[model samples]
Target: MIRHHPDKNLLLEYASGSLPKGASLVVSAHIQMCAECRAQYRTMNTLGGSILESCAPQAVNDKAFHRLMGRIDQAAEPEQQVTPERSKSTEPMLADAPPVVHKLLEKNPPIKWKTIAPALKMCRLKTGQDQYEVSFHRLSCGGKVAEHDHRGYELTLVLYGSFSDSDGVYSPGDFLLREPGDVHRPTVTEDQECLCFSAVQAPVAITGVSGWLLNRLIPFRPG
Candidate 1:
């Protein structure tokens, strides 16, 4: 069972189509995994339509509207399916992630994972947007990332295994939002490795004596 979920306000923002692209992507993935959130989003959409219908009808620019619809139709075309490639060193299957995430993965597969720490590996997924950095993090059994706090906001979805912080443990399908002033060190459970996907608005601010050094040496990057 999933213990965590994005709050109602974020869901409303997503339904209203005002959320930032990367943040919206995270919320969309959560909605797909959680039936409760999906229902909430659908209800919100229905309510929005009713509200719009109640308002006075506005004049339409037919040409502009048709152009927008054409672009949307192109974007909705079915994506070709090809089995994702995997390297022997890769920790988990891309199949483990939500379907929406597949749009970012390369068709060639064998995702390039970087070793940022002894037991930590990272794989970045390009979003073609500058406002947020999107990536996946893998921590080995009993491993933990350095204690740090958010500089902006972070939305992380657990895709495999489990991890724990000061608040509580998170398992697959758990969605966590960390805003500024929030701090935690996540440690993977001893039984298995933990894998998670995240979209962040800014680099984290690591805490501790080595924080400055680590921060300088390993400033977060989209790659």
Candidate 2:
């Protein structure tokens, strides 16, 4: 189950084709695995269409409506089958996955290196100046991350294994969001390594001894 979701406002921006390609890719993937979100997306799309029609003085073109209906029908066709045996054959199956999943897993924007701690390493995917940043963090088993607070929105999506904090346990595929001012210390599971993709709006404020050490050895600032 999805532990966190993009708010209705974000979904509306996506359905209206206003979101950037990279951000839209992530949102689309979340909607595919979440039925509630999918329903909400449909409702938003309908509402947006109604608003446009209400504001426009000219009548809608019959040919344009027919073309749009055809495209929708094509998108609704049944997905192709994939055998379990075939799925395991590929190292990366993102290409063969659904459109939304494929887009999310696409190799683009490139990740740049950033050291978090001795036991942790991060790579940031640059979006733009003063905008959001996505990062891939690799944590060694039993490693403890420095306690930190977010200045803006922070979304963490677990891609492998699990971790825990004061609030609760987060496992693979779990989506967690920490709004501005939220702080927590995350500890990786002793039995396995933890890998997460995090999206942040601002630099994290590290605290305590661990933070001091990390700050001296590596740049802990946001990308």
Query: Considering every candidate listed, which one attains the maximal TM-score?
Result: 1
Q: What lDDT tens digits, residue by residue, belong to model 1 across residues 1-223?
A: 9899999998887776667777776777777667777777778877987999999987779997897575445222212122243423344544656656665664325578788777788887777667778888888999989999798999998878999999999998899999988999999999998888889888887799889877776656642
lDDT of candidate 1?
A: 0.76
**Candidate 1 positional error at 150, Å:** 0.9
Question: Model 1, residue 47: what's the lDDT?
Answer: 93
- Residue 163 of model 2 has an lDDT of 89
Candidate 1 vs. true structure, TM-score? 0.85
TM-score of each: 0.85, 0.66
lDDT of 2 by residue, 63-135 (tens): 9889767545533321222222222212231223334333333544433446667668787654333356666
Taken over the whole model, the C-alpha lDDT of each candidate is 0.76, 0.63
